[model samples]
Target: MDASFVIHGPSIKPGTEIELISNTDVAPTAAQLLSVEMKNVDGRVLTKVMM
Candidate 1:
């Protein structure tokens, strides 16, 4: 997909302030699972799981 946008504003004088804002929408994706391992003082695999 394709899109375009534009914005306009007025000029500011001395000691004046102005603000411009824009917003966009985005889609979310699925999360991936991973395995984690733990070790003890003897350096041994304790358990593994997906997260």
Candidate 2:
């Protein structure tokens, strides 16, 4: 799979980087940032990027 990305957001720490095992993790990670719950999701929240 060709999986690579450069994500920038207010909650993301500057000059920080992380590796994700699956693209599915994106949805859960974004939900965490907004403090919302996503049903039927199997992805983990990306704690490393949270402010």
Best by TM-score: 2
Clash number for candidate 2: 0
List clashing residue pairs in candidate 2.
Answer: none
Total colliding residue pairs, candidate 1: 0
To one decimal, what is the Cα RMSD in angstroms of model 2 from the true structure? 1.6
lDDT of 1 at 18: 25
Tens-place lDDT digits, model 1, residues 1-51? 444423222321233322322222110001111233322322322112111
Candidate lDDT (C-alpha), each: 0.22, 0.80
| TM-score of candidate 2 against the unseen true structure | 0.75
Q: Please tell me which predicted candidate would have the highest lDDT against the true structure.
A: 2
What's the lDDT for residue 21 in model 1?
21
True-structure RMSD for candidate 1: 21.6
